[model samples]
Target: MENLERMEGQCLCGKVTVTAGRRDAVEACHCGMCRQWGGGPYLAVHCDSDVQFVGLENITVYNSSDWAERGFCSECGTHLFYKLKGAEEYAIPAGLFQSGSDFSMTSQIFIDRKPGYYSFANITPEMTEGEVFARYTP
Candidate 1:
């Protein structure tokens, strides 16, 4: 297991805040749903379930799929996390956290679903949509 570091961040309007264990590597999700939700690929860090939220009343969670949900700050419209249902896992947007300058882009998922108009310069590992399902889904 890797050592986890504590990190903190707040929503754009400061109405919501998060304190969580930080993962060093950043990942991009290029699936259509992710792009549609964010207007681009989602750059995130895996924070697992070691997260605490302040101002719960200001947060809104949307069930994006049967197995997963997306969260945002209702007051500021800041995207919060993509979480797996009934699991201790979360993909929190990297940009939301402070001191994320050291986070490295290490992987990209849903490569097959990525649009041709955009691409990343990093030569990180890539996973297709099917591969992601096979590897992550039980």
Candidate 2:
């Protein structure tokens, strides 16, 4: 559809530029790799399917697993987005987006696998691996 929110961002060296559309939902992930890659929890925003990706070919994708892929800038090492095979959508890290955008976090995935050091004060829905597999598995 039409662009919902005009958001722009770049990698550390400004080599990778991304423009997302209609991103309003965010999710904070405390998974081990997410923490290691970002030095903290990863904040992802669910952008519209029509997002205009520029310089995306420059971004290298890592197949985190058979079902998931993580995108990052090869030069600056800026983690960008995560995509799950057959999941019908992509997840862009909220921190990678331009600041001052209007967005709110919705859900926290892999809650049971989240690191133990951090505790969430807000009452958000949590999902375990079994729950995710149960819901997504055919």
TM-score of each: 0.95, 0.83
Provide the lDDT at 106 for model 2: 69
- Best-performing candidate as measured by TM-score: 1
RMSD of each candidate relative to the true structure: 1.2, 2.6
The residue-by-residue lDDT of candidate 1 on 8-89, one tens digit each, is 9888999999988866889999999999999999999888677999999999999999999999999889999999999888
Q: For candidate 2, lDDT tens digit of each residue in 19-138?
A: 776566678776777777778787887765655567876799899878888889988888878888767477788877767366666678778778677876767777776787798677
Output candidate 2 Cα RMSD: 2.6
TM-score of 2: 0.83
In model 2, which runs have C-alpha deviations exceeding 4 angstroms? Answer: 1-3, 86-88
Candidate 1 clashes: the total is 0
